[model samples]
Target: MTIGGHLEELYGLPAFTFPGPGETPRELPEPDAVAWRITADSYDAEEQWTEAFARFCSAVDTTRVRALAVGAWEDAYDRGPGDIIEALVTARDRLPGLRSLFLGDMHSEECEISWINQTDVTPLLSAYPALEEFGVRGGQGLRFPALRHDALRTLIVETGGLPVEVVRGIGASELPALENLDLWLGTSWYGADSEAADLEPVLSGARLPRLRYLALRNSEIQDEIAAAVASAPVVARLEVLDLSMGTLGDDGAAALLGGQPLTHLRKLDLHHNYLSEPLLRRLRETLGSAGVELDLDRDDADWDEDDDGTVHRYVAVGE
Candidate 1:
């Protein structure tokens, strides 16, 4: 249920964390479909993750492996994912069936989402051409070089603060078969410096023809993003549009209602927002009549208004 945390499942695969030195390994029903996670015990533990990865590769028939979820690497706050990525790339020939990959699966206990260091992940997509789904959490030092992956269907980037380079890289890159793109555009307090112009390519739907589900969640500038997405060519073809977990207020909701006809969408998720009761009622009255599944969970409604006349709109994840 939590973003930037350990995923319960991915691509229809139940998550299975690999056993550590003294830990017990549970019995896996469908081993091939299991989303195997590898991690080091402590952040400062040296060379443990590589050892665990090696042990996993030796024990499991990786040729049948479909999903890989990389948990905390040794000293994840200091060390980056370069070595781990190379190790996976080295075993690409062995992992002929790998389709789904998730990097930086550590939760707050290991490292804060914004503190997790990452690097250019273009190699993973380049090496594994047949990959259908690729996801990564944490945006610090994260990079996605310009590249096209024909078979990729789903791409999810969950970050406390998504960097501008990554956002532009995503827009510039070509994903012909991509159907779902979920981005948690967290606040700029960490590193999110992306503006509306950066998403022009993505919003234009110039390259992503198959994209049906688009989520621009967990943002501080949710209203601006909503206004942009209102006129986005991609929205017309999308089956689901998610703008949840943001600082979205009445302005964003009004822009959405006024700009586009969202009756064609299968669902609209605007949960964890700061909308007023009247706006929520209007959204329900409008979208509900069209049979569109509308989610207007506004737990932050009262929290936005400060003691003074000022308002404090914020995203779900700031740390």
Candidate 2:
């Protein structure tokens, strides 16, 4: 399944809540539970944060907790939510059972998904070496230092504008157990400097052997990416190939349809693209006949020409 599928599973499961400041029951419902969330914004003021967290630590048997969520830590105005990371690091020993962590689960009211600035999260991996699933939202100031992990299975980075260096860094990393990898390569206007060539390591299938689900969604240059992916050796092993939420026009869709054998893939997501109805009907017949679950939700808006009559296309999310 895709990371999106896994996250949906996580969201559906019931969670054990860590009581906030003004909540009725100020306690941990199940200290030994598998899923839990720490919403620091519940505290009345920033001054009460430390003490509230201390109480949370005291209530829960941290050593037995498996999945922990860090959400709405220090508001959007704060310094990139680094303080929450520090707190987790300080209490690292207490959370030895932590395997899955979801960072930046704040709503739009707390912080717009794209506006949530994040710094280098390399330290988190070093601190929790056994962590298997790591999900982070936002891309501003985000950096993943040289990493070598043995237990990490799923790595997800959601962003409005991901840098090329970050993609290169992921490709350069040594992740022996990685199975699912999702990267939202947003518009160039934000910070998407990387081209399709930058993803050569992943496309060549030289870096990750266990990878099965790969998502290169939300991109401006979806056509180039689609062409590269269709010819890449990695597609031979991938069960789900997601090229959703992009500006994939007829040319890109045609490249994908003509380049590879779609019978092997279990599912293909091309929702929110610029394919015409004729192309969509063709895709539905071809891919559906191959028994692939296809997602072709949004039709693109009509293209507009600049003063020089140059046509321009756009991706789903960037700003």
TM-score of every model versus the real structure: 0.95, 0.89
State in Å the error of residue 4, model 1: 7.9
In model 2, state the lDDT of residue 14: 49
State in Å the error of residue 139, model 1. 0.7
lDDT of 2 by residue, 82-104 (tens): 77777777888998988888776
lDDT of 1 by residue, 1-319 (tens): 2343588997798998888877676665455868999888445675578788998887788889999999889878886889889999999999999999999888888888888889999899999999999999888899987788999999999888899889999998999999999999998998999987888899999999999999998988899999999999999999999999888988999899998799999999999888888888889999988899998877654354657878787788767
lDDT of each: 0.88, 0.78
Worst 10 residues of 1 by lDDT: 297-306
The CA-based lDDT of model 2 is what? Answer: 0.78
The top-ranked prediction according to TM-score is 1
User: How many residue pairs clash in all the candidates, one count each?
Assistant: 1, 0
Q: Count steric clashes of candidate 2.
A: 0
Model 2 segments beyond 4 Å from truth? 1-13, 32-34, 42-52, 299-312
